[model samples]
Target: MDTQIVRCRECPLQGCDTFRPLSEDKLEYLESFKQGEAVFRKGEMIMSQGGKAPHLHTVLSGMLIRYRSLDDGRRQIVNFMFPGDLLGLQGAFDDDLSHSVEALIDARLCVFPRNDFHRLMGAHPRLGYDLVWLAAKEETALEGHLVSVGQRTARERVTYLAVWLLDRALATGVADDSNRLELPITQAQIADMLGLSLVHTNRTLKSLREEGLVDWAPGNLSVPDMDKACKFAQYTQIDSKRPFI
Candidate 1:
């Protein structure tokens, strides 16, 4: 982790249509707000549940997961992060994070000191609003996930997860031109996210594959027609264009 502040204006994410643009004044302050860059290898823990994160992070590149693990050793993956996604800001209002983040692949982050969340909001209200927007967006997606786990069938659950990630990946240009995700995740991880067992997850995935809805493997997923998959999963996609700090 380097402690040198990064120039937010020059951030590559700023050039992507996936993220909202910052105003001249706001961009300048964001540059100062950044404390530096943090790089993580695949499977590295970015932050842990019940631990303090010294800095808030925005995904500069690559993929990661936010998950919560229970005492019995079961874990549920709550969310995934792509370029421009914010991380660790939930620590602002509380002492420790409710969940943990881990890199799914080699990744880079533009980090801002955790304490400055207040300064950004109190001094620069617009930037603060952006933070809330980011939080609310994640909340909305989690709500959908909750509904799926609570009521959807095993097949529907798998379909929903694939659709959810595929939609977001395409929106972020993280997926290839072929509309496929070289997802750096395993079937066991998928089971965790969908609240299913590994055996059940595998069965459902085979069914989907046979049905021609998706082609999924340990580190890859392909959705040929997202609309059809979404319809099958009864998934409502959040707008592809999203705000990020």
Candidate 2:
């Protein structure tokens, strides 16, 4: 597919009725502004804290991190972006950004200029409704991360993170009950996202392997039975509106 047509073609999010409620014509139009290039380099700030919002970005590939750094240089990653995640829509209607968005890998983004985006939302009320839902989902994901950091044991934290990805991948139709899925991320990245030390992450993975909850191989993972894995992680299903028909 041509890079400029990504929103209409390869955007995993274009069909996600929750995040995208625009018609194909609108999507095609929205995608045309995207320019089809690597938006930012890893560690380069896409949107800095306190910066005025300009564009709403949809992750087309690779991962991004939403993080805030302390005065002492300590950082906490609030959320990790996946294939279909949205950035810049979780903030105030008129305030500056509260956190910085950085690519964790070489990532591509479909950029929607804020002015045009607002016009689109006005023209399609369903798009506005869907944006609200997407923001709520980001909040929910942040809450989940908070719980993992605050309450879960090391093993449970690993389980929580793994189960999180498995569920997300399946929900997005990228994986299934078989737990067969692509995993292009590293253990260090997983630790950062889960708020775990590298050693602790290894221990947790070893424990999960011993208990047969999941298996990790080169470039992928096998969950065997997603339900069983979810049970191990104490995962509970949340009900949300079906965003994609």
lDDT string for model 2 (74-160, tens) is 666777776666777744366788788887666777666665666767766775676677777788888888888899888777777
The best candidate in terms of TM-score: 1
What TM-score against the true fold does each predicted structure earn?
0.95, 0.77
Instruction: Report the C-alpha lDDT of model 1 over 1-245, residue by residue, as the tens digit.
Output: 77654578787767777777778888878767777899899999999998988888898888999999998988899988888789887777667887899999888898888776777888798778777888888888889899889999999888888988888877776876586899878999988998899999989989999998877977889977788899999988756567677
What is each predicted model's overall lDDT from 0 to 1?
0.84, 0.68
Off by over 4 Å in 2: 1-3, 7-45, 90-92, 173-178, 216-219, 237-245
lDDT for model 1 comes to 0.84
Q: After superposition, how far is residue 236 of candidate 2 from its true place, in Å?
A: 3.5
| Error in Å for residue 105 of model 2 | 4.0
Q: Relative to the unseen true structure, what is the Cα RMSD of model 1?
A: 1.6
Clashing pairs in 1: none
**Top candidate, metric lDDT:** 1
lDDT score at residue 171, model 2, on the 0-100 scale: 58
